[model samples]
Target: MPEFTMSEKIYREEVHFTGRVQGVGFRYATLQVAKEFEVTGEVKNLPDGRVYLCAEGAEREVVAFREELEDRMSPFIRESEIKSDFRPSSYKSFEITR
Candidate 1:
């Protein structure tokens, strides 16, 4: 695990999850998990039956959050595509968007 300090870098990840992700409380569950971590961003259902998520925070927290979420929701997720980048933080909290 990586320890991040206020002076260290923050990372952002854009994730798209496919499978039984829609209509299965996926976004709500993701929001619940997000609250447990120090991450900020949003989760929403796409029209193509995928769940899209954007999270930004300390790199360790964001990665841990994603791992825990996947562990808890593995039964519903068939495939996940993740893209990560370095960017300035833009969200104050995590949310479930439409």
Candidate 2:
């Protein structure tokens, strides 16, 4: 797969997912799912018991990533809040952050 340039990212958003998302390999699964999309981002566990993710890509790609994430993680995600218009971080690949 080709590396996605920062310049190619036109949509960026941050998501906070609540519920059983912490101990369920959420970050790792997120990284895996990310491998299928041409997006750049990071996923991490938050101290407030939510999973945080920031993804950037073309609008369609980023939105699809979010949809798939929700579909695959439906059982674990109880609530989620998505905030669009996040500042791009120039991430080269998707990752799980400590």
Candidate 3:
């Protein structure tokens, strides 16, 4: 039998989504998607007409969270920019920020 091992890296991602990403429940939708993953972070509407999402967790989990969120909100996202790191962040829960 093989045993599963969790990733030692705590990956963090800061994603900025553009095009129709605001004024359309983007933040709320992001919050809903975050609940489906182990990642903890926040999503908010940027003043420059973009949606900002910051998520951190196990490497795979964090990546999966971004993938799922992108898939779920593809229609509203015309483009996206992502910055990733193998660092840890403190976020007690996922949320939609003002």
**Highest-lDDT candidate:** 1
Report, for every candidate in turn, its global Cα lDDT versus the true structure: 0.92, 0.88, 0.85
User: Candidate 1: TM-score?
Assistant: 0.90
> lDDT of candidate 1 vs native?
0.92
Query: Which window of ten consecutive residues has the lowest lDDT sum in model 2?
Result: 1-10
Per-residue CA lDDT of candidate 3, range 1-98, in tens? 44434453467899999999988888888888888889898898888999999998887888898999889889999998999886546687888887
Model 1: CA > 4 A from native: 1-9
Instruction: Write the residue-wise lDDT of candidate 1 on 30-83 in tens digits.
Output: 999998999999999999999999999989999999999999999999998999
TM agreement with the true structure for every prediction: 0.90, 0.86, 0.87
The alpha-carbon root-mean-square deviation between model 3 and the true structure, to one decimal in Å, is 6.3
For model 3 the local lDDT of residue 57 reads: 86
Candidate number with greatest TM-score: 1
Identify the superior model by lDDT, candidate 1 or candidate 3: 1
Better of 1 and 2 by lDDT: 1
